[model samples]
Target: MRPIRRLLVANRGEIAIRVFRTARRMGLETVAVFSEADAAAPHVMAADVAVGVGPAPVRESYLRPERILAAAKASGADAIHPGYGFLSENADFAEAVVAAGLIWVGPPPAAIRAMGLKDAAKALMQAAGVPVTPGYLGESQDAADLAREAGRIGFPVLIKAVAGGGGKGMRLVEEAAAFDAALASCRREAASSFGDDRVILETYVARPRHIEVQVFADSHGDAVHLFERDCSLQRRHQKVIEEAPAPGMDPATRAAVTEAAVRAAKAVAYEGAGTIEFIADASEGLRPDRIWFMEMNTRLQVEHPVTEAVTGLDLVEWQLRIAMGEPLPLAQAEIQLSGHAVEARLYAENPAAGFLPSTGPLNHLRLPKGVRVDSGVAEGGDVSPFYDPMIAKLIGHAETREAAIAAMAEACEGVEVWPVRTNAAFLANCLKAPDFIAGDIDTGFIARRLDALAAPRAPSAVALSAAAEAAVALAQDGDGPWGGGLAGFRVNGAADPAVRLFLDGKAMLGSPNGMSERSVLADADGHIVVFEGGEAIAFTQAAPGGLDESSGDGAIRSPMPGKVTAVAVEAGDVVEKGQLLMVLEAMKMEHSLTAPISGVVEAVLVSEGGQTTEGAVLARIVPT
Candidate 1:
């Protein structure tokens, strides 16, 4: 280990800010590397010094280890912390950092490689006596071979890319017929994301609980576990909610899993922060024998905050200390677990619209006040398509899981983001769900109830009345209630002033009343966006006798900046309503664009392999 005086965080967004917080506290100067798209990001301002790596695209920016190393050299940084996503697990990057004589604030290159690939990691875990999921890790990449293996294992098997993480290169195939297509999509995503299309098959745990134990080791060869986290709440295999001290984990089960996790970590000579992920058969109610190892995350996890909340430990501080050749702060016996904590990932996406990414300027942003918030963007910041759409992480801590859930629910309901959609209401619903409250959950819990959970929320009548009152107060051309501008207005005697307002374009009456807090905001254009129940409902005042209106046109435009992967329809092709026209890959996920109405394709404005910016028309469907 080398002395690290100046640290450069080779990443962006909240993770970079998070690392900078610890580095600053430790009396180390922090440096940040940003892309052109992130030139104005808060993370850059959080650091003592910042450097520009390249343009917006990750290929030219964050993914280029050489550029990061160059930034470190230019900034006189003696250490590099590859914060979670871009190249956190890239063995080559770790090696290069060492070769450049900079301390790598991560695991050793050998450890990263040993657990980077799903197949190889599972093999290594099995060899170390860790229980692994019954599946296939055969070396052959033939489609036929994998399909045969899937049949032998059974239907409803999981197809996972060998190098996949963050649910990018994985698919759940429920039947034999869908296997081929799922395999192809998985492979395409795998190649695009990890540069490796090789996949592995796993027996799908119908009622699965995603359990991972946080492990830390040091240069002195001492290791310990920070208990475990339940990351079972997920959508499309991506974790949405995480909690520490997994619900229903008995004492025996905890001991078994923790010991197994330590064994896995010691096998790789793991140091710093790592997580040993496991999949449990929740159908049997979280028995020790039913749990099996899935894979090991070689670097810090996005859900590390929950672990920190429970154990009162700063994992990043431990990483820095370990990298500085220090011993483990405490042995396993000395480490203690405290209160329960829950974390909900707030994303800039529309849950009702198939969870498509929503990109725009955050005209109004208000995170919950009572909980821990890890945010990278501010009130006027833009949520662009150049990176992950996660806006903030809200964590709630309490003495019990139920209390934590309640706090988390209230926090989620207090979120207020306008112009851009969010899944805040959806998260609140999950927190308050009867099943979730009872601790009866699994990995497929969100997927099974996605439709009902994502049902669009409408402002209540009381909310309308509140908005109307605020709008009237703001309309007086003055501030607050009972201003001199409202001198001519009657307060109580007559029928309350009935003002026509459009709630999301639907004409409604804002029952006039007194003014309230700033919970309801009126934009410069006099359009008021009401924040209630985690929903941001826009209300624009209608003219004396008219109302405002909006509609979707027949043009199919890219939702955000992305690469055109497949063009399903061409010019002159007659397509029906909701026909798939094109597929765009953005932020490591594929989005399918469909025809709005039955029509003939007038022209295809973009072709396969072309990069497009937000709102660029890919095709025009002239309604027939």
Candidate 2:
């Protein structure tokens, strides 16, 4: 095989950008293929040349083999890199690339096929004497048949999509009564996600730590494992925090798991980069006997940075070399892990609103200065509702696991973006949590702490003061004193002149000029109001628009962009203080907007599917 001079990246987002950076360093020109929605994405901008593939949908763009091949041909690229996801694991696509005279910078098509189907892969592992999870992989698709099999396997079983990854088609049946329903839902989601409804049932283990070994292979049948990553911190089956040299893993168990991973990769004559995932029970310390094969990721994972940080080697470069027929550069004994690393996926989502996907134009993007940020979008780039809501991957490296965690937490707090709600603060909280700090994490970690995690905390006094200062600055800009001066003079001078001041959905009525002084009088909540030292207070009034005084802070709005999918009620709708008001769908997920107080909806500003920019009004409610 000839060395690659040019490569086409058949993916998008951070992975695409990551591969291109490595390819450039290796003196290889990179070609990026993007959908219509990603034309202005950072990955496209970073590539030496970019080709338009199709529309925003995955089927038409990133998943279309024909379009990818066409782009490769147009760019004169000799190899194609299938970054994880979309068509990355499609054996047919890999075969097609090879058949079209292009080097596939991934495992051979046969290897992909060997590990693509969960049932077949499990059988293969069992045959090789590798640990396999006890489960049912029968050929029956009948719900009753699956249910019966689940009953045989025991009460708690996992219904997993055999043909996909990213936790898209998975369900856990905790009871016999819920087996059929869970199975049907799993099948439907699997069919929708991977076009294959074939699912396998597995005995679900409680408190399992998700561990995976990164393996590299070459054309000469040489392979080695690169330790393991603990990725148990997940939400909705998707990984959130990933770390290297899994804590609490003993050397004996680590050796066994890593060896098994190497065997699994070599069994399929795997070449290039691959990952063998394992599920190990953490009820006891990690042991070789307690671990079982879960699945193999046939391409570079999103959390590859953690692996790279500890090894001080670029996996992508190795992939390119292996694809060019190079032998493994080092044996398993020579590979060394020097330090610990952790990676957090920064997403455009609202943590206080059930972690729903957020979409909007990025008004400000400031990543932490000292850490590594792998991202595909930039400031002013649109976090579209059409794709994944991930904004960036923040990775921190340190000499120890604890230090890495601390560094990651600090980095998250330092990174900031405007107009789109994010889970940065939540991530910081998680890192600081004693359970997480002690590495006691699992798939159920987030779910069990959902209420505490999503609880809205009041803004700090400093933050409130800053916001007040900003409000005052805006007021003093000579923008026009429509309502008069600090003396509380009103333009209409009526008993009550209502001027709209958007304050976290609450209405504040006062002389427009009342905003100028450090202290002013206003009406808040049918009472006398006073504003002092950047705070507002409320009291009772004799009339409907009575004069009052108070001091208080402001409200919190949506940080990012998205579409309002549901409005819980209409005007005059009496809602509880925390009742769900609307659902916003962005980046293909739904987020619930809740009521701030027990109030009547005075106005519904946005409807389902209505496009909303950052700070766009969704509704207004008058407190009861």
Candidate 3:
């Protein structure tokens, strides 16, 4: 059992920062590896030492096992921590780290390999006496044979890639006629996502709830479960909001699930931090008999913070201790769950724009106080197109579930992100939704209420008034016409002061309040752009006579920098309103650009497989 003297985190962003914080508390120096794009990232600055791994692309940097090992060796780091993404679940990387004579702050490579494939992991779980969902794991790749298996599993079956997670390479077939197309699409996605085109079919549980138990084991074969987290709220198969001590879960159900998690761990001789995911049928309330083992995540989870909050434990610290041959810190019975906690991931995306990933500078970012914020980017930091768009996570905890939910809602509402759109308002609305508040959550909850959740939200009258007042105040005594120094001189006593401001090129007129109502001024902090009521409105002195000129033709432009994956139209093609013109892939998400009006496509400026920057016109349309 060798204690680690220095540790190198083979990851980037918030997860790296998270592990570094714990390593520091353990009196271990930390080294960080960064890509070219992240040279000035917050994680790099937080580390005691940093090494450049490679270029901006993850394939050339974070995913390169050789570069990571070399960085660790050059830094003299005795241990390496693979924080959640890139190489966290790569079994070969884990084995290579151990072979290099460095401690790996993770589970055994054998255990990771056992759980790497969902079908194999399910088979292992069933063999270990754990209840598993009914499925077919046969090796037959014939489409006809797979269809027959799907028929046996029944309609609404889930075709999932064996080596996939994060909702990628998964499809649900609700009817027989659509099975072939879904199968083909799923296979294509699987091949692209996991490099494996093989898939397994499972009976899809309607109205299911995702609950995972956090399990930890030490070198001595001792294992304990750190309660459970409810990750039922999701979009695109990725968790959006997670809570600890799942609401509406009874004592019996909790005990059964947690015990099953430990059993699964013991079967593989698991070590360090792992999560056993279970899908619970919630058509009826949560019942132990209805819950089935789905798969095991052989590494720390993104929602680990929620579990840590309720357990009053640092999971990262536990991982370090267990990796160093230490015994489990506490017995299963000694571990206790304290208060309830909820966490919301703040992403740089536009919920209303079909949740398109956004990339730009975080012009103004102010997280609400009185909550825990795990962030890897600072105000003015660029949300680049090279990595995940998650900016930070906000955690709120309280003695009761209701209070915790309320606190999370307040935190989301108070957050201020700008330039790059975010889902802060959407998250706040979800927390307060009638169904959500009553704990009526399931995997289908987001899809069922997506229209309401992603609806275009406008600023409140009060927010508009505040913005108007702030704009007038800034323009007052300033050089612009809206400023008081030049424009405040009223020609008549009967005329009220009016200031012209431009928001997204649209002119706005506003009036200042009387001195008695000027208290709202205190909330102003000189932000040229302010986020209020779920919308960001930028206030700039309008040009005299609104003298903006536009070209004769309507040019459909790309909203963000990305690659044009598809072009649906050519020159001289007639299009209808909202017709798909092109599709742009950015930040790992696809955004479809549509026609704003009926017109004839005069020219297609962008070719298929071409790249474009924000505001780059892809096509010119002449109104019919």
Candidate No. with top TM-score: 1
Q: Taking the tens digit of each residue's C-alpha lDDT, what string does model 2 give over 157-273?
A: 899999968877788888999887667667766765688989998998898889999999999978899899999998888898999989988889999999999999988889999
Tally clashes: model 1.
0
Q: How accurate is candidate 3 locally (lDDT)?
A: 0.84
Instruction: Give me the candidate number with maximum lDDT.
Output: 1
Residue-level lDDT tens digits of model 1 in 386-474: 89999999999999999999999999998888788999999999999999989999989998898889998877776677667766667
lDDT of 1 at 308: 93
The root-mean-square deviation over C-alpha atoms between each candidate and the true structure, in angstroms, is: 3.4, 9.2, 4.7
Cα error, residue 78 of model 2, in Å, equals 0.9
Candidate 2 residue runs with Cα over 4 Å from true position? 478-624
What number of clashing residue pairs does each candidate have, in the order they appear?
Answer: 0, 22, 4
Q: Candidate 3 at 367: error in angstroms? A: 1.0
Error of 2 at 18 (Å): 0.6
TM-score of structure candidate 1? 0.94
At residue 164, what lDDT does model 3 achieve?
83
Q: Evaluate residue 568 in candidate 1 and report its C-alpha lDDT on the 0 to 100 scale.
A: 89
